[model samples]
Target: MRLPKDPTPIRTIEVVPYDPAWPAQFEAIAAPIRAKLSPLALGVEHVGSTSVPGLTAKPIIDLDVVISSRLQLPEVVSKLTELGYVHEGNLGIPGREAFMWPDGNGRHHLYVCSVNTPNLHYHLLFRDYLRQHPDKALEYGQLKEKLAKQYPGDMDGYSEGKQDLISRLMQEAEALSGFALHQP
Candidate 1:
């Protein structure tokens, strides 16, 4: 649980067409992690673009392994480490801890977040919104495509560029889901 001396480099952003196999890929990755964490993991779910069917994405699965409290985070981090993931503390987002698998396992982003955190809720709400609205998902896919092209080598820029769109979508999603948007 020690931080690396150097930061991980931002790689070029590459968005690919929707792959039907993405869900299965998530299951393959989640199963073992879930088994290892057991009750400490309130739930483990696939979130982000890969979770929605027919949405073009970067092809990296985004997962959230939820816990009941922040107190459990260290244990979760230890468990994930045993599974070969390096804990990469929140990466600027509070209420969630990021983890990266050693090179070559697969392309994925994993996070551990407490139940009911705004960040976690946002992820679920946004994912479900896209799932229920194909047209909106298509719009989102298009946005990602444009952003990826504009910020080809800048991951931060790509993500930053999507903030406005994501915020608007999240507001709509929060209304639909009856969860007040929590801003950090």
Candidate 2:
């Protein structure tokens, strides 16, 4: 199930070998948000497959900027908007707030969420787990590659299909941190 030869004008997806510069790229992008929303921003982290060293990804850096509460969203969104970010709302994930990163190349996802929420914590736990366990990261990479081929243009399908595998890995992640799931 290879991806279509010709895709839409949006260029919603692309395949690329992991680059060493992704972390720095995330840091560069997170800096301004960190400065402007320091009061609300608890911690900014680099997550997603690209953050791992040897994975193939869509060449997009994914970040999570932790805040204090959902009510703080408007002010944070305003700050991000001032920096040219396009607020995309949840895009389906109810507890998570996603943004369309403004570089025009569709190469980053700047997700905003509060520390009071579990979404960001889960992402961080999973990422950290994969970072500490390279074997798990490899397994996840293979699963992702297979899924991307299976549901090339269907983001929702691809994401949903990977839920089981993700959950299993996340269980391991949570155990590693001794962090039980907190209802969001």
Candidate 3:
């Protein structure tokens, strides 16, 4: 039996070796958002594989715009819009909100989550754990490389594939950090 080639254009997924400049890039992206949202935004945190030193990633920076409470969500959304980010309304994640990046700056993912959001804790814990354990980070990097090749062009497929490992690592991260996931 012959399988037909799918007509959908495969979006290129490029997983590259960890770049030392990722931290600086994060800082650059965070600075303005930090400045614009001052007092409202608790902090713009760098997470994801890019934030983990020496971890292979898709090169797209991931950030969390933390707020003190959900009461601040409206204001945060308004200000981020002024900063050139269009709010994407949590994208099915309850506590966190996603955004489209501004034109003319490098590509990145921006998320907003209040202090008690589990998503926020997940990202921080996973990134911090990977930073502390280089061996595990390397293992994660290898996994990402393999998955990128296996699921190239299917972004959803790529993300779904990493869930099992992500879940395991999240558990390890939570245990090590002693931080329990909580809802807002």
Cα RMSD to the true fold for all candidates: 4.5, 5.0, 4.5
- Taking the tens digit of each residue's C-alpha lDDT, what string does model 2 give over 1-184? 8877665442334556678988888889888889988888888888898888877677888988888888889999999898888999998887788888576666788898878677787787888888888898888778778877888777877788879988888877777788977433
Question: Could you say which candidate leads in lDDT?
Answer: 1
Clashing residue pairs in candidate 3 (N, C-alpha, C atoms within 3 angstroms)? none
The lDDT, on a scale of 0 to 1, for candidate 3 is: 0.88
In candidate 3, stretches whose alpha carbon ends up further than 4 angstroms from where it belongs are: 1-9, 182-184
Instruction: Please give the ranking of all candidate structures by TM-score, highest first, separated by commas.
Output: 1, 3, 2
lDDT of each: 0.90, 0.81, 0.88
How do the predictions measure up, each by TM-score?
0.90, 0.83, 0.89
Which 10 consecutive positions of candidate 3 have the poorest summed lDDT?
Answer: 175-184
Q: Give the TM-score of candidate 2.
A: 0.83
Model 2, residue 167: distance off in Å is 1.5
Instruction: Give candidate 2 regions above 4 Å deviation.
Output: 1-13, 102-104, 182-184
